[model samples]
Target: MKRYTLSSLITRLASFEEALAQKMDAKGYVEAAERARRYASEIREIRDFIIVEMTLEPIETLDPMEFLDDAANPEEVDNLRRRVYTKIAEDVEPVSGELADLLRRLSS
Candidate 1:
């Protein structure tokens, strides 16, 4: 069995955030749509990365952002984000609240 280190997961999250900053070069209010797409892509990558690194089997996290349509509210977003990370945490090692906390930031 493989031993999952929390540091590695955390490092991966940090690296993802750094790369997100670099890739999202879309500036200003006019380019909001472009920025949203870039942001969504980065989030998807991080979600997939975390799921692959920490899961026991393949998990389908489908874009949580998709749930935040025109009718969705802030409470709905919070609930969806909470559920996604909670489900991930319930799966395997590095199963700490810290891991949950780190994963939660991916959508923020």
Candidate 2:
């Protein structure tokens, strides 16, 4: 089994976030949006699990400006945040085998 570090997970999550944004912007791309939502949920679950395991406080405030400083429209930032939060609230399947194995190793 392959091992994954926290930094790697964070990097992967960023990629997922970018993919989700692109999907959200694409016209008539329902399937892509669904896939992006799944990826968002997975990323959220992994992040929450790690925070709990590490006894870290959950981030309470997310400043969209931090990421969207160069964005042309402020509404786009709000839309992105809403989509991410909605995905996080939605029910998701249990973590995949690879992530499960990684968690097991981390907890060992």
Candidate 3:
């Protein structure tokens, strides 16, 4: 059986998101956000590959602006952060699972 390439998955997802972003409305914003969350999940899978293969931390540091300590409204900003992270995490599992399986196959 042929395997799907990570690059192909990412390109297809990005193209879909770009197309969806063209619409203007609350629905479009929601769709864009959903796509972004999926992209973030794919990013984390790529991060895992860098960590596993190159032995490196992918992100150098968190942006201070993203945190409560730096935001004007700490609670609101923190809540938003939590929501975004949660959404991204929800999308991440399946992609990461696929990556893990690929890695296992490579090693075996």
lDDT of each model, Cα atoms only?
0.41, 0.42, 0.37
**What lDDT tens digits, residue by residue, belong to model 1 across residues 1-108?**
123344444443344333333333332233433433444455444444444454444323323333334213334434554654455444423444444654556434
TM-score for each model: 0.35, 0.32, 0.28
Model 2 Cα lDDT, one tens digit per residue, 1-108: 122344344444456555545645564455545655555565556655543344322222223224443323324434554543333222111323333443233223
Q: 1 or 3, which is superior by TM-score? A: 1
Candidate 3 lDDT over residue span 1-108, tens digit each: 113344443343344333333331234455445544554355445544533443222222222223323322323333444543343333433544453343233223
- Evaluated at residue 28, the lDDT of candidate 1 is 27
Ranking by lDDT: 2, 1, 3
How does residue 81 of candidate 3 score in lDDT? 42
TM-score, prediction 3: 0.28
Query: Residue 65 of candidate 3: its Cα lDDT?
Result: 28
| Lowest lDDT block of 10, candidate 1 | 62-71
Candidate 1: clashing pairs of residues: none
lDDT of 1: 0.41
